[model samples]
Target: MELEVKPRIYVVRLGGDNPKLSTALKLVRLGYAVRIHAKEIPPHSVVLNPFSREILKPSDSALLRRYGVVVLDTSWNSGLEDLRSMVGRRRYEQRVLPVLKAGNPINYGVLTKLSSVEAVAAALYITGFKRYSLEILSKFKWGLTFYELNKEYLERYSSTKSAEELIKVQNEILRSMGLQP
Candidate 1:
């Protein structure tokens, strides 16, 4: 009998604004994620970066399983600056999630404005951890709704075998929504 090794999930908390509404802290409390400092981020791990040029795809599952995934928790106001500071220095594999609507009350229906947990779940789902993704999202009342809002996109993104294919699907989706790809 072998115990299944759960892939590590890490959150780098740089934004202390509105701690009460922070989804990243909630994840730590629920034991679904671990809180670590920016400097502690593992090398070659997948770091969710909104400004990243690389798109996360199913092909990254093996890497994720071996190196783990990370989500940078920062306020929208300081997000870009926070990301910029960490982008080039760390040997992290930064990835950007394709367009997806937010399910959190604060940013509901807004595209690509996901909470920390939502971003983590999206990365998990895209990396072939669908069941684990749903598990984490189930902890929050609006978490599952995130999946509901972007089910079609999530499904299509997860089905892609490579980043190029994933980008193609995402472009088509954007075009269909009348948004420039």
Candidate 2:
């Protein structure tokens, strides 16, 4: 059974001066439902956050299909305040993607800090839209690197049915890599 992504994706850019070559902007060029400096957020959508405790799992596909996904576009340096402000603006279901390596030049091989497009693609992949995820990642040269590095983890996360199970698996993966969970 192929799961379809229903809710349109919405991105809110806090204040990072748009870079000349931006992954988020690349996502926009690829015809994704991206909105920069979005003023309003749809209620009940799954908002992607690196800091959120609620792990995004394959089981959340139902919700993604129903309410769509929202991404917070901010720089790692100056976006935290913006994220905090946006959190209270609307009632959104926050979710964090499982452990994954970055393919972006800035944070390649870094854990958990994924580019905006990578985060969106990861969510799409974990939720069973593998093709869509790949299609989105194809826009960047380094995109494939992200997939190659985290393929196993992504596959593992995609196979889990619940957030709890995914979290347990993520913990194990972290431990194996000599990282503290």
Candidate 3:
């Protein structure tokens, strides 16, 4: 039987703040991901950018399978300057995750404040890699909670074929929650 090849997961740890609590660092330790500098991100890989205008879709799975995925691990306290520097002119494809509540201890229940691992897992899940996504999240104590909290949204988002569809689903979810979309 031919061995299956998994997409590479890369995390760029900015400023190295609170390494102990870093889910991205934990993933690296568990041998599920790699630590790399911002400049080292492979060309055409999907870079998780919260500031990105483009929303991630199931179609992007092809890019993830071929060029892999990247997440920038940084402190919320770290100013946008750090993030802007990395995302400003990068060759990588930048895509943002839809609004989802955090499940990590630090920012639990807060919208769009997922931990690094949560962000990576969300990307994988959105791109049709549910098994790998759960496997990565299983490594964290509060990992599964992230999935539980966002399962409805994840399921809906993953089924979307395009960014527009994903946005429409996100809006519907938000409207149902009585929040302005």
| Candidate 1 residue runs with Cα over 4 Å from true position | 1-5
Off by over 4 Å in 3: 1-5
Question: Positional deviation of 38 in candidate 3, in angstroms?
Answer: 1.0
Per-residue lDDT, model 3, residue 174, is 89
Give the lDDT of residue 141 in candidate 3.
89
Ranking by TM-score: 3, 1, 2
Better of 1 and 3 by lDDT: 3
Instruction: Provide the global lDDT of candidate 2 against the true structure.
Output: 0.80
RMSD of 3: 2.6
TM-score of 1: 0.94
TM-score (C-alpha) between model 2 and the true structure:
0.90
| Candidate 2, residue 181: lDDT | 88
Residue lDDT tens for model 3, 42-104: 999999988887889989888999999999888877745677765555699998899898999
After superposing candidate 2, which stretches have Cα over 4 Å from the reference?
A: 4-7, 36-39, 88-90
Ordered list by lDDT, greatest first: 3, 1, 2
* Candidate 2: residue pairs that collide: 7-68
Error of 2 at 53 (Å): 2.6
Candidate 1 local lDDT, 43-95, one digit each (tens): 98999999887888888887788999999998987667887766655588998
